[model samples]
Target chain A: MSAHLTEIIVFSVLFLLVSGMGFVAAKWRAPTDMAHLDEWGLGGRSFGGWITWFLVGGDLYTAYTFVAVPALIFGAGAAGFFAVPYTVVIYPLFFLILVRLWSVSHRHGFVTPADFVRTRYDSPTLALLIAITGIVATMPYIALQLIGIEAVLKTMGVTGDSAIARHLPIIIAFAILAAYTYQSGLRAPALIAFVKDTLIYIVIIVAVIYLPYKLGGWGAIFEAADKKFQASPAPGDGIILNANNQVQYFTLALGSALALFLYPHSITGVLASRNRDVIKRNMSALPAYSFLLGLIALLGYMAIAAGVKPLPGAKPGSVDSNTVVPLLFDLHFPPWFAGVAFAAIGIGALVPAAIMSIAAANLFTRNIYKEYLRKDATPAQEAGVAKITSLVVKIGAVAFIVFLDPQFSIDLQLIGGVIILQTGPSVILGLYGRWLHRGALIAGWAAGMGLAFWMLWQIPNAATGRKHFGGSAFALSEFGFDTPKTIYVGFVAVLVNLAVAVLVTFLLRALKTPEGVDGTAKDDYFADEGDPRIARRLPGTVEKVSST
Target chain B: MAEPESPHADTKPRTDSSPWNWLLLVPIVVPLLTPLFNHDEPRLAGFPLFYWLQFAFILLGVVTTTLVYRMTRSRGRS
Candidate 1:
């Protein structure tokens, strides 16, 4: 059979497997009622530590991550490794931030960070901005996952000469995702994550073990990568970092660390855990994926060693770098093994896309819909809103992939990181103290967002021959900072955000402007698993398990 | 001073040496340590040593997850 046929058959089987898992997920630990937001959106908020660990791990380490990180390393050289350290740092930082968030969220029954922002700062406007930012940030992320699926399709030779024809499979896949996600709510992805993560593990392990022997050894891979980098005109374009990219490196790593936990989906995973300890335990453990990521990053070097070239007729240096892992497998491994690796990437997309859509949907429902559209909406109504909103989010993400350049979608992902980073002061900082004036926090968010956009506008993609700044991250020098030092624009934007917030807070306090009342008690921040006041139990009004 | 309430009080009562209580640390620590032992090797089927380490970690991950589940159930019974 032709390679295209082989790929189609393989992808069809995998798609069935994922969709079957999604349908089956509603029955796995099946919550009795699907009408309530807690049940539909938060998986009833009773997942044990292990479940939450897998769920969050699967949620954060996505198909885009699986494809993009390596693809980046393949294309840009050492800079791609930035994702590794950033992921590593995220867990430790979250250990402190998440536990507090869990306690406070549990006390107030918040499903989204915007909900907490609303109550803590007593500002609907701030909450609204957060909700919009979350949706905007997440939309591109969901679109990026489609890029992973599209990469597979292209490798499989499932495309037309035109862009629309090339992306038809992605559109169909997302349509299915939208349907299932809407039906099952968060439970769909939470359950599917198990299958997705299991597949990814199987594929990565087999490839890592099998690929090295075929290509000679690690020394050879690094040598090839180094030779490639040295040959390139770009100063820093090879196997290791140079002086110019160091500031960009450190700032990107730190910026990403801050940005990772700030995503609404990340917070959703944390809140779904059974207690604070689950959050604590997952924080230290999730770094394992970072280690896995480090391994994945090395795939770039492996591609170089294997002498894997982009497909014929591909643009100069514009070959689908995302296909490197799959191409590596096809070039060296048995066909069956290639099938499994393809399945892993395909499933990886589903897990995070599901979570991103759910998180975005929750933001719209709790922060926007219930807050504005229907204040007296019943729990069932709220859940229905969330379900429909998830559908919209999935469809919107699909549209982004189908309509816009895939590279632009990646730019949006970086932009999403920048936008979400604005929430750090509101979510992360607010956890420690309420000293930040809500008004100032709003002002900071605007300033940071503006600067982030301006920085993003300056970055130009060299490969596509596009001139405008196109990716999610930016270098400090790009902003015309006179200092020779480089920084991630998100990092700089966040600093500006914090500075503006601090300045505004002091001004508000001096002027004796009314700070809104905090709905949560101070003791709530320290509440743990056994706190009687916040103990887990059936709500007083629930008359039956199947009420929905 | 009053003894702090047992954090696991909301669930089944805890017993001394309950495996579930300790299972918590496995996911937390295993991922953190796996990298220290990770080393580079030649590519097999286009994958490297660091890549294989991820697979090894995944195996370790599965074992840890199973152990945690079993411990939780056993502790609940005890």
Candidate 2:
């Protein structure tokens, strides 16, 4: 820590600045009352185009964008670029669908996706299942963000020989994050998103332009990357996709794109918007971050061109590939600038972690606590429970890093996408209509999750030497095919989920199984801001005025 | 039977569904068809076809969504 004083100081200053902003963000919007879920968990649901743009962008792109994508590109070649296509398609795919969600959520006072599920289907059991799945899926994702900050810390020589010393920085960082999120709720990340995005854009733009100029041109970088892959023994390592992995690339891209907005954090960001137009306008605007992300993915190849090696892992002889991007900046840029870059990655982790915890907490509060634990809990009590749950969620994420191997978190994130995608037939499909019966939706979810786990159990990561739950790209040969071509696990699982849903819906209809009440109307999906129907039900306005 | 809520007794005709929503499919489908642009030839500034084409897809997505937003904005309220 003493050797790299400049980087540490610079990183510390920017980090402390954001930490200050996080604490002060409690008053940024100065909500009329913070005791309501609308204010505490959803930023008062008044975010307009610009704030929604930054908040959602910050929530989605994450440290995964800055650290993980480039690391994957460095390790796997063109396969890593799947994130580009995944993000490129996410906006257009979710553009119209999200507006319907926005309009309805505002109209119904829904705080979590499970809240919407509960009200839409009128089934507390199904809503509880959705809420549990969301919390389980989100825990690993929050853990992944810690790995991002740890990668940056390791690069700056902040790591130590002992396990406690090595993980101390991450714990302290998350403590600050948990504290501010507990105090400020969703607004902490919303306010700090502005600073996080500005720093990231500056860092990424400079790294792309200046690094390429310094280490030969873009042509030279690609040439060096191609040359390295040619001699590499790994089948997936190439400057372009090959036959064996092309299907995996396409399916992974499509599957991830579909799953992107389904995450509770993503919905948290969306539901916090002011209205439908904010979501619509943001669908067009958010892809600007994808352009930056594509450039960031290329930093992997740039790391190869510069011959930047990853730092040693906690285990002997293993390398932490997530450090590639940080090491690239540390090797090329001056200490002060590198510190800024590290701060960008570190804070990048915080915004999503905060949003994800808030999202998970909201799920617990609205769906679990309100539905089962305390049916008559007041809005203030719900807010208090959510705040406490947010702290526990953050602590759970920290324990995930401290007690378990970080590799487990990575595997859980891969499984997280598959788990969250199961909610599609219930949540996403439920938004359009209620043709699928509630019993069928539950059966479909069970089938999807079971098949996804069984499939994931077969994949073995040769690099990590993990036998089961190794990775997401399951081979086609598992079905007795005579080929090495593989497909994404989630993609295959979701198709089965939808198929099972349709089949079960028909069978259940034939059996005359009763369907539950859908509390929403068709026009509810189309209602926008200032709609009399929506304005009347919005939480803070109606309930507060009536009580007063 | 789960009837419509009393608040929605005055149901308006559904005019918000637009054909322009189908245009959004262009961005989603074109990007997934990797066979069209997955190649090493036609490099742009040293970016292989695969790399540069994805950047183009981002632009395509933005343009298509923006177009749909403009066209569908008025229809929803009417």
Candidate 3:
């Protein structure tokens, strides 16, 4: 069979497998009622440790990550390795943050982070802002996953060079994804993640072992990458880091770490766990992906060893690095192995895209629809709204890819990171204590968002010839700091967010502004699975509580 | 359905934390040092420090995950 035909068959099989799993997931735990948001959105809030591990791992380590990291190394050299450290740091940091979020969300029966913000800080406006930010940030990330799949399609020669012809397959794939995700809610991805992660681990393990021997060796790869980097005119292009990129490196890494857990989909994954211990266990274990990421990053070097050249006038080094893995497999492995690797990347896209749509849909259903449109909406109605919203979200991401310059998708992804970071004060800080006033949180999100946009406007990318409108993550020097030390714009923006929150809280208090009623008790933050006060109950049932 | 008990709910907080808890730092520290010890001079399998260091990290990851499971589990329950 032709390569394109083989790829199509592999993709078709994977699609059927995921859809079959989605149908089966409805019975995974056999929740009492699929109509309720809790059962559909949070998977009955009863996932055990192993299930939670695989689900969260599959959610966080995505196709965009798998494609982009190695592609980045192939394109830019050492800077691509930023993904490895960022992934490593995120888990340990989450160990500290997520346990608290799980406790607080469970206590309040919260599905989205914005729900926590609304009650904890007593501000509907702030909750709305957070919900909007999450939807906006997530859309581009979902679009970027399409980019990963497109890279594979291009390598398999399934896509013609014509713009319209190239993206038709992706559009169809996403349409199918939108349908299943909308039908099944988070359960679709949670079930599909099992297959996606298994394929990724198997392909990467075999590639790491088999590729070096097939090509010359690790030595041959490194030598070629070094030669390529040394010859490039860009300062710090080939093998190692240079002075100019260090600040960008540190800030990008740290910014990504802080922003990692802040994504609504990330919290959605964390909240689905049965208890705090699941979050804790996953945090300590998820860094295992970093080891895999390190191997994946080396594929860029492997591409260099194989003398894989970028397409003509493609900025010399910039021919879609996302294609490197697919290309590597095509060059070295037999057609069957290549088909499997392509399937791995294809399935990787579905897991996160499903989760992102579900998370975004939940944000809209809980924070927007129920909060404003229909406060008396039934559980079935809420699930219906979330299902429709997920379809709209997937369609919107597809439109983003179809309409805009592909590079804009990357910038938008970074902007999403900065935008979601605005929620740190409300979500992360609120978990520990509710000291900051809700109004202050709103003002802080505004100021931080404004500053992040202004800083992003200053970065310029030379390759795209896109000036003053490039990367969204900012370097500290732009803020007039003299030291070599640079922090993520999100980190800086979040600092401003916290400062405004704290300062405004004091001012509001001094003015005798009402702090508003807290709907939860202080002890609820420490409640666990069997806490009779906080346990999940049948829909439409109510439990009496002793007034504190 | 029966009420599922929280595993750590009744357990007392660790009064004397093990030094082993610090082993969590190994994955983070080792990866960072791999670049520094890389010496910019490439070698393979003889003193292939880069590859060896990364392999060591995989081992470190296995050890840390096992340790975390042991530390978090109940003394008698497991």
Best by DockQ: 2
Quote the positional error of residue A107 for candidate 3 in Å.
Answer: 2.3
Error of model 3, residue B49, in angstroms: 6.5
For candidate 2, write residues B1-77 as lDDT tens digits: 11224646565645457899999989988988879888998999988898898899999999999999998887665
Candidate 1 C-alpha error for residue A241, in Å: 0.9
Question: What interface RMSD do all candidates show, one decimal each?
Answer: 9.4, 3.5, 6.5
DockQ of each: 0.06, 0.56, 0.17
lDDT tens digits by residue: candidate 3, A284-337: 677677778788788888888887864432234445656777888887877777
TM-score of each predicted structure versus truth: 0.86, 0.97, 0.89
For candidate 2, report its TM-score: 0.97
Clashes of each: 15, 0, 1
TM-score of 1: 0.86
Tens digit per residue, CA lDDT, model 2, A1-548 = 67578999999999999999999999997876788888889998889999999999999998888888898889889998999889988898678687788877877778888878888888888888899989999999999999999999999998888989999999999999999999999999999999999999999999999999998999999999999999999988899988899899889888887787789999999999988889889999999999999999999999999999988776677788989999999999999999999999999999999999999999999888888798877788889999999999999998888887674344568789988889988988998899998888899999999999999999998887879888899999998999999999999898899999999999999999888777887877877777655444344563465466
Candidate 1 lDDT, A250-330, residue by residue in tens: 577668778878898988888888876677666656767776777787787788888888553344455667788778877
Report the Cα lDDT for residue A83, model 2.
Answer: 92
What candidate 2 keeps of the native contacts, as a fraction, is 0.73
In candidate 3, how many Å is residue A35 off? 0.6
* Local lDDT at B66 for model 1: 49
Give the higher-TM-score candidate: 1 or 2.
2
Clashing pairs in 2: none
Question: What's the distance in Å from true for residue A356, model 1?
Answer: 0.6
